[model samples]
Target: MAIRGKTILITGASSGLGRAMALSLSHGDNNLVVTARREGLLRELAAEVEAHGSRCTVAVADAVDPAACQQVIDAGLAAYGRIDVAILNAGGGTPTNMAHTDSAAVLRIMRVNFDTLVNFLCPMIDHMRDVGGTIAWTGSPAGFFGLPRSGPYSAAKAAGRVMLDSARVELAGSPVKLVALYPGFTYTPGLDPNDVPIKALIIQPERAAREMLGAIERGRSHHMFPKRIRVLIALGRLMPEWLRRRFLRVASGG
Candidate 1:
């Protein structure tokens, strides 16, 4: 599955991981559908993607909104005859204390992180099952465990991890491939310092994007950035629940 000539739709393309992926895949003949809430930035991205001699369409959409997410899919279908890859990369972390975090804030985080995936999955699955395609949901190291100050992010990403991993059994042998792309402390504007158990080994968004695209091209089930964290996540899962909780507490400024 070379990405060169494929039609791919990417959310959160205004900046961060989504932007990096879009730029990286811009060189080929792929028809790109890039979406974000910021219309101005999306227009600029369209110019950049087109400069590479590929087709690009910009859609101003807020992934947290169900209507906006559907619009993204519709925009892609209208621009390209078919969709080959969908990068469900809209997400953010909210700083909240467990003692008394606002429910509204938690819901916003979940909407951006989890609900968007579910909403997009409906159209993605249907289109892919009928015409064939691939979907990559952005999971996070936060998904691997619960952490203080990032409870909502942790829970939502954990749910994403579970969903993408389990989707394989349901879609086995189908032309459509589902995957979870997990990144730990990857570089992004204002989110560079994604502190975790370890302070070192954080990577840039482009590096992780390369790995993710490679996995998607090869049809791998899941792709984890900064392999060190993937190994640590495996270890954490093997640890006792009490020990995992204690470790997360210490790692997350408890």
Candidate 2:
């Protein structure tokens, strides 16, 4: 359970939450395998991590490609020999307006959010089961229920939640752990403050990542950030379907 000396692989490490996690874990006696399509940024991060005395490896692979997924696994294994944790964080959302969703755009989102998620994690899980590792996927409060303009994103993340839970049940007796990081709206710079007025309450990525590491270390079933958002998601789920839809519509300006 100690995080000080384990090896962890983090996708989406070029920016945002993944970057924060890399920084948070840099001082630990750990090996970090960070990946993204942005090779330059990834190497830069690797330099920072290495400077802190942790072994750092960088891979440039598209999250959605089966080949890329293989490359990620190979690279991580090649560098660290064992993976203690896999943070499936490479994902993005399209503009919620369906009219703006051209065929190519929808396919692209599906590829990155769903296909890539599975492609990358499936092989990693197979490897983990042999050695008893933890895998945590990045999910969102939006995945808890359908909200207008967030159709594909919600569906993909909801699938992640369900699939991870099912996988956990299947491996009930194993040391391997499957978890979801269901974060609420983050106060990322330039993101709309109008939508999440209480964004000040949003925990920074390092805080969230630190919590996530704790959950993994203890073998928690699942975890969510911003306790209030988790409460809202639970309430929204228990609400009648019609009421839920209405509330979501009103809240999202649909």
Candidate 3:
């Protein structure tokens, strides 16, 4: 409920929004269990979190691996005996090229954005179902509707969006709170504008992380930020299919 004195487990803590979240929530009352592929960055973050008077544990593993996800959960339980919040924030995607229809690339995108979340979701629900904890996923507005050039990413996040909706229904009376966080155009590492024309809506990782943390604290089932993007998504949903496709083509710089 309140963010203090909670055991918060965050994946993808090596950099970007995940790192920002770890820094933002690292107060004396909190115990941060951070995991990611980058052990070096996790160690650096663990030190900072500890310096802030909170306990920190680093679990270096791939979030897409179910066994690694389990190990991260176990590490938190081993240290604090409970996890009050779990943030599944590991994902990334490349701009789609219609001509380059590589099946492997499509699968990799799905695994990164959607499968990774599922890998962590199963274990988190099982462990927190009875004890009652918050489970948050890093969704995207691309999930709300399919984008023109980022088909794989949009499809993956769309799956996550619906899956979390189902999870909310199933965990209705349980303590586990399911949340889907839709962050639009975040300026985080490995997510550059490059050719994508989303620069106008980009927000820094710190600001996005702070807002996300607040939303989670409030126990919201779904949250989207940077008012402008929400407006765009709303407008996009109202448009005809062909019109929406044209809008996405321009917005995504296709």
lDDT of each: 0.83, 0.80, 0.87
| Poorest lDDT segment (10 consecutive residues) of candidate 2 | 188-197
Candidate 3 lDDT over residue span 117-144, tens digit each = 9888998899988888999999999898
Q: Mind giving the per-residue lDDT tens digits that candidate 1 earns over 109-142? A: 8877898788888779989986778898888877
Error of 3 at 14 (Å): 0.5
Better of 2 and 3 by TM-score: 3
For lDDT, the strongest prediction is: 3
What would the per-residue lDDT of candidate 2 be over residues 1-254, giving only the tens digit for each residue?
A: 26788899999888877887887788887899999899998999999998888889888898888998898889989887889888888887855667666777767766778887898778987897778888888888878877687777888888888888888888898868887887777645423556563556566766776777777677777788778888888999899999998987777766
Candidate 1, backbone clash total: 0
| C-alpha RMSD by candidate, in order | 1.7, 2.0, 1.5
Candidate 2: residue pairs that collide: 96-149
1 or 3: which has the higher lDDT? 3
How displaced is residue 155 in candidate 1, in Å?
A: 0.8
lDDT of candidate 2 at residue 234, scale 0 to 100: 90
Q: Would you estimate the TM-scores of all the predictions?
A: 0.94, 0.92, 0.96
